[model samples]
Target: MEARLIPIALTIAGSDSGGGAGIQADLKAFSALGVYGASVITALTAQNTRAVTMVEPASCAMIAAQMQAVFDDLEIRAVKLGMLGDAQAIATVAAGLRGRDVPVVLDPVMVAKSGDRLLPTDALTALRTELLPLATVLTPNLPEAADLLDTAPACDEDRILEQGQALCELGAQAVLMKGGHGRGPECVDLLIRANGVTRLSAPRRATQNTHGTGCTLSAAIAAGLAQGMDLTQAVTRAHAYLQGAIAHADGLGVGSGHGPVHHFHGIWPNG
Candidate 1:
């Protein structure tokens, strides 16, 4: 038999001990979407569904070594970046990825679901100057987008559209303004590229198990891109996948607080 080859997608992020978000979620989503997953963990958090108790960041040398190990061997088609803890980590990641032609989906993960600060205040400057320009698509929730633009969070559709455009003008190739934090019965994600803006809306499923939704969505988008899909097609498929996962979120009965969406929902029965 001929040797099998697979598309590889990379996730550079922190570790969620809870397994619902960060590197764990990214890996799971990558597998479920039929893409090979590689990871470079920037930080590790002692966290569960309720809160993050502690965080430990990796050294710049270690981070660079890991990225080099992967890049030297594997053909990484796309990358999803999340939870860069501080200025130094962000700078290291940016330097490692600066000239790569791979599609980078940057999830400006500043805060955790439990309301813990994942990215430091001083790091925002590095994120904007060093990282944002490297992204093929930037995914930011309302609060993150607001912080990135130094404006109040958008509460309505029009404001969110404006924010997306502003972010695109900040040098990111494209922007996906996530509306999960918006007040609505539907989740509206706006995709703004050079062509135009496309709104992806799905009925919001009521579930506390939405802890990893953002990470999963961005990872899935990267997976699609790795599979050679266009930006709009990848975003559309990612939105559908996320909606399905949210609708079938597992009630694993593991934690007392927010649970997690089933990454393998399509493969497993009754997720």
Candidate 2:
């Protein structure tokens, strides 16, 4: 009898010591979706829900080595990029994954919930020129989109669609414009691809546990893609998973600041 094969997803991102966002969140999301998760840390931050005090980036050589090691062994079906510290790291990641035939989900993680900048301001250009073109799906919140576009993000539906289109024009095969930062009764996420734009809407849940929402959503999407779902199906599953996680995020008692969503909300006890 042949042994069963598991879908593998790789997350190339920074490490959150607090275990809320970045690699920790990505791995949790992958596991919840039944995907085997691998990681290549680009940086390490002394961070918690409250603030990020210090950050130390890994050498480009080390980053490349980690990625090579993973790709050499495991059959990675999807990749997620998150919280790359600088232009050099971004370039390293792009070079490492340039020819890989896998869906790449790029989460433009800029600022932490505690108001600390994750990606340096100087690295924005590298993200645009080097990384954007390589992404299969670019996931950015309203503020992130604004930063990338160097313009005010639209709040209304019309403007949001325009922004989504604009992001797609930046060279990503698809763009998922997250609307949690936008003002509305419902959170509307726009997925723009070559085919068309898709609107995924969910009721806004009043919760402070949104620390790792972006990372988790992107990771979940990667997991879905690794599991052989189409782009639309993957996005839909990810949206549903995020909604449930946010809704069930009541009292984990993690930290004083913005807490983390229940990553394993689907399988947790009494979830």
Candidate 3:
């Protein structure tokens, strides 16, 4: 019998005890998308659908050791970055990724779905300075984009593109400006690269169970990249996958406040 190889993606992020976002969501997305997942937990959050009550960041040494441990043996084809807790953690991750040749999906996860602060306001500068320059894809929602730029969220298409350009100028190889927080019947996501910007829009889904959306999307993209998809191809597939997940989120009946999307919606019948 011949040996079989599997595409593997790495996730460096926090852990949500709620099992909705962070490392749990990332691993689920990877598995759902047919990629093997490895994780390095940077922080641990006491959170559920309703709120984030407490957070504990891992030590810098442990973070570095985990990254080394993963890269040393595993054939990590892509990386999905989520909630890096502090400036030191960001620096540690950036240092670890400085010379890697894998595709990197940086989610810039600043806040939770419940409006709780995940990354401190003081850590934004560190993230922008160290990580953005090395990111293969930077996925930021309206508020996250605004936080990165230290400005107000864009209310229209033109401003959104303008901010997207501003982020590109800041060193993100490509920016996927997410519009989940925008108003209207349709949600727009712009894939802004050096060549041009491609628009991907889908009708706004009316699901209160949209927790961990950003993490899932980026992780799906990493999974696609691990499976050898281009940026546009991966983003397109991830966008559609997220739509399906959100569309069927309410079926799960997970929590009371905001619930989680079904990462296995495609695999399971009627989720």
Candidate 4:
């Protein structure tokens, strides 16, 4: 009898010592979704639910070496990128990923849920020039979208659509403008592609344990893509998965501040 083959996905991001966000959350989402997860650490962060005390970035040589090692051994089907810390790291990652055939999910992670800065100011230019064009899907919250556009956060639906379109113009094959940061009864996420735009809306769940929402969502999308789902199917499933995770987050009493969402909501019984 032939052995079963598992889909593999790679995450090139920073490490979250808190075990809630960054590489930790990405791997959890991948595992929960049945995808084998690989990682290339670009930075190590000392953080928890409360705040990020410190951040130490890995050298560019090490980052490139990790990428080469993983790509050499694993048949990576998709990739999810989180925090790269600076312009040099971004350039290195972009170089490593260039010409690869796998789908790329770019989560422009600039700030932490605890209001800590993750990516520096100067890295924005590098992110735009180097990574955006390589991304199959770019996921950014309202503030992140604004920061990328160098404009104010969109408050109205029209502005949100405008910003989403603008981000699509910026080079990403598609852009997922996350509405989690918006003020609304329903959190509406827009998936803007070349041909059309898809709107995925769901009621905002009342839960403070949503620390790794962005990371988890992007990782789930990568997992879906790794499993061979199209863009709409992947985004829709990822959106639904993240919604359930956020809804069930309170079940796990992880930290005092913003806790992590239940990555294994389907597998684990309710509290």
Regions more than 4 Å wrong, model 1: none
Q: What is the TM-score of each candidate against the true structure?
A: 0.98, 0.98, 0.99, 0.99
TM-score of 2: 0.98
> In candidate 1, which residue pairs get closer than 3 Å at backbone N, Cα or C atoms, i.e. clash?
none
lDDT by residue for model 1 (1-271), tens: 9987899999999999999999999999999999999999999999999999999999999999999999999999999999988999999999999888899999999999999999888899999999889999999999999999988999999999999999998889999999999876888999998889999998877778888889999999999999999999999999999888888885455487888888888898871
* Model 4 ranges with Cα > 4 A deviation: none
lDDT against the true structure, each candidate:
0.93, 0.92, 0.95, 0.95
**Over the stretch 65-132, how does candidate 3's per-residue lDDT look in tens digits?**
99999999999999999999999999999999998899999999998999998888999999999999
Q: Give the TM-score of candidate 1.
A: 0.98
Model 2 C-alpha lDDT per residue in residues 1-271, reported as the tens digit of each score:
9989999999999999999999999999999999999999999999988889999999999999999999999999999999999999999999999988899999999999888989878999999999999999999998898889888977788887788788788898999999999876889999998898899999988888888999999999999999999999999999999999888777577898888888987787532
Residue 105: error of model 3 in Å?
A: 0.4
Clashes of each: 0, 0, 0, 0
Clashing pairs for model 3 are: none
lDDT of 4 by residue, 1-20 (tens): 99899999999999999999
